[model samples]
Target chain A: MNLQVELEHHRRVLIVRLRGELDHHTAEAVRTKMDEAIQRGRAEHLVLSLEDLTFMDSSGLGVILGRYKVIKSLGGKMVVCHVNPSVHRLFELSGLFKILAIYENERTALSELEVVS
Target chain B: MSEKLEQISDHDGNFMTLQFASRSENEAFARVAVAAFVTQLDPTMDELTDLKTVVSEAVTNCIIHGYDNDPNGVVTITARIEEEIVTITIEDKGNGIEDLELAKQPLYTSKPELERSGMGFTIMENFMDEFEVVSNLGSGTHIRMKKRIESKKALYN
Candidate 1:
């Protein structure tokens, strides 16, 4: 349950790295952490790194969708990177990839976020 | 009949059971539950993937809707095996679903503000051979799901 976030205000980009399981038990914590970063950092671009996410359920999806709406409302962009194959399938089945951009690595996602900003 | 939680033995090499507090705990347990129950069966990678996805859906529903997010509510998960079938039952005594049919409809979530896709039942149905939701307004919900194990030969044939 380690969620690390770094904010680059010049580009209005926020990078979030999630570790451990992202099921119902941990979704709320992740959501709160992301929300705090978004609100306090005033970031217009969001990039999530989920390489260490061992598990994710629909609650994880809810957290992602909720944040997506938040960023979209501010006319910002959101991207996810380093998603494991299992979690990637959930995103695919949920059609989340159609709405949110995904990258192969965090640096790529951050670079892309900067381009958008 | 007694409003008591029971731990039934895993019978027919089909199922196993675990009880936990609240929806969040149940969701976490669901992952471990599936892994342990299916381990002895020596399932293929694809089968493991399918079971994990279905377990997530079923356990999430038991916690969110069945237990109404009550942190103190209890969820009982029973996984059973028959010949070539794997059946899982998740039961919770919380606020029961009002309309089973309406609840099963895709994208119909009582907690829309939470961004729930309301596709839990839909996903479960799609991944399993059979899915059933039985509930009473004030009692609780029982989600029973079954999936037929596809033989290795079936993949090539």
Candidate 2:
């Protein structure tokens, strides 16, 4: 499975639009790319746009949890938006929804981050 | 809900077994192959995703904790389909789990340094209708999962 990561620079956040499957094969790349984007952007928050994310497993959960720790340690927040039902169920089962903010769309996430910022 | 549904409803009974080296790459292949085979059951998107995730977790365990990342070890997956039900068995001949209870606990990973989420078994239990795990210290681990795909006809009612 190939993961296509598109990083968009916002004023106080990095908007990460991920496409394709996020399994063991592509988790490492997503982690690397997201870390780089967060560091390079020097942003205070992260908005993960998962509208196009097709699939995700526990490996994907581990990566997301690891990044949540990273952004948390940095005192930045992370929000996931446009999650499909399948991936959303993964988030629910992994107990990620308790820690990560979920939004319906990118605009909602950006606006929520604006308030936090 | 997809084109794959028609192809599966026509088949009566299908069974297949796949065994390969306990390599990380083989995990992806195991998932795709089993998922492809299961399409014959006309599973919904959610069902297919759940099945694939379960396959990946089981195979990954075989490669990592089962064989300790040994490329020489082997992982075998057997899938059987009857009507709307699919049964998948993942087997590995490697050092097995020492504590079955601890292994099943959520967020309990023997190797935390590897950043394992420890949600593999949890996901499998939740996704499939029936889940079973058998392991011994030196023998190996076997995971059997069964799920019944609900057809649209059943949903309309």
Candidate 3:
């Protein structure tokens, strides 16, 4: 369960790039890290970059949804980018695509967040 | 579902059963082992990924839902490869699901505090060709899933 969470504070948006597998064993760490970052950095929007995410299960969906809720409650928008086919399917199945905006890369996601914020 | 499981037992195929403590860490090991086991059939990358995801889902359910994250509980996985088909059955001897139907619904997590997506069963069913769950109230849950792998060997021939 190797997952790397790299966060970059771009203006008022936080660009989070995740690499490796995200599952039940590793989701907690990500949730904690993102929660802390969101609160501490006071991000106005979030850009989740999953370009290097090799695998994700329902647990991954839960963590992403949890963060989405956190950002939503704070009056911030959260967008996801670089989702692989399999992870994309999970997002579609869970209906997260309907609520969250998706982009092709971190730059686009950040730019979109910038416009909205 | 039991009859289908019996059919697999009666057939001649490569099979392996793994028994381990219901620890969260074992979730990775369980899915990887199953993926490795089915490698002999040479599943496609998508097929392999689907199998790995379902295994993770079932094993996670055993640890979280069945065993309640009790590391002391035992989780068993039996996987068999017959021809181009792979069958995996995950079992646990812990608190069984009280309402199996409700448990299968999407976004219906019993433990919302844990942030469970409640998409485990749905993923398992959609990813595999066939999926079934049989569990008793006091007993544990048994998840049996079967997928027909379009092996490269068959594709070329």
Candidate 4:
């Protein structure tokens, strides 16, 4: 299946749930959507929920890294949750796990961010 | 010795080839085709996932780096299966890499402005049993990879 980006805003946090494949073919759309959402919503924190995501490549890592940089520059944080093993492998390969905190689920991510924000 | 060689040759050699334009839309198509072809070996979910990721990485490099995102450029993929081992080669007819070493370094993307993580080669190397690159300054790039599928059937045997 193609990629789908679903956004949920909670207070100043924006939760993006990605489904399907995220690759070079679909990364640009996801990047644009997330950037616009962050700006329009004035989101101070980002939570990426990948429970339904089936596939991701380095292009997906680039998108995640770019968004992390954006949020970091704004003095905010970005965390990812529900990452499948395949996607987690990419995160490890790219050294992204060093920078981005990972949670077990969306509720846990939101609660953790709540304590911080 | 002749009998041993004959037995080796008797092994099945299944293969498929694909050719498409260097367009972003075909990225998914290339990976999925390779994954589908690999199913004959009955790869586990993780192995299948790894194969798909490697295919995506190679195809992306062909489109973005080799062809410079030129739709007119052509990309080709050839996959061959011999017993439990799968070998895939992805090639592109575009401007070739000037420095293969730098290109393969993790987090060293030539097109940082495009938000490339420069993890393409790294991912391919990490996920596959064998990865090789052949490229010239103006001739284009060829990536060859091989992985032995340890299917449940193979394990049971």
Better of 2 and 4 by lDDT: 4
Q: What is candidate 1's lDDT per residue for B1-157, written digit by digit as tens?
A: 2323233442335445677787465565576677678665656766777788777777777777776677888878777777667788878887888877888886678888767877677778877788888888878888888877776336546
Residue A50 of model 3: what lDDT? 93
Backbone clash count for every predicted candidate, in the order shown: 6, 1, 0, 0
- iRMSD computed for candidate 1: 2.0
Q: Once model 3 is optimally superposed onto the true structure by TM-score, how far is the C-alpha of residue B24 displaced, in angstroms?
A: 0.7
* Best-matching candidate per DockQ: 4
Cα RMSDs, all models: 3.5, 5.7, 2.8, 4.4
Rate residue A114 of model 1 by lDDT. Answer: 79
Ranking by DockQ: 4, 3, 2, 1
Candidate 3 residues A1-117, lDDT tens each?
588999999889999999988999999999999999998966789999999998899999999999999999999999999988999899899999999888999888887878887
Rank the candidate models, highest TM-score first. 3, 4, 2, 1
Off by over 4 Å in 2: B1-12, B152-157
lDDT of 4 by residue, B86-114 (tens): 99999987788988898889999999999
**How do the candidates rank by lDDT, highest first?**
3, 4, 2, 1
C-alpha local distance difference test of each model: 0.75, 0.86, 0.91, 0.91
Angstrom error at residue B120, model 2: 0.5
TM-score of chain B of each: 0.84, 0.88, 0.91, 0.90
Per-prediction TM-score: 0.84, 0.90, 0.95, 0.94
Give the CAPRI rating of model 4. Answer: high
* Top of the candidates by lDDT: 3
Please provide, for model 2 over B1-157, each residue's C-alpha lDDT reduced to its tens digit, 9 standing for 90 to 100. 2344455445678777788998777777889999999876667877788898899989888888999988999888878888678889999889999999999998788987766788989989988999999998898999998988896437656
Clashing residue pairs in candidate 4 are none
TM-score of chain A of each: 0.89, 0.95, 0.96, 0.97
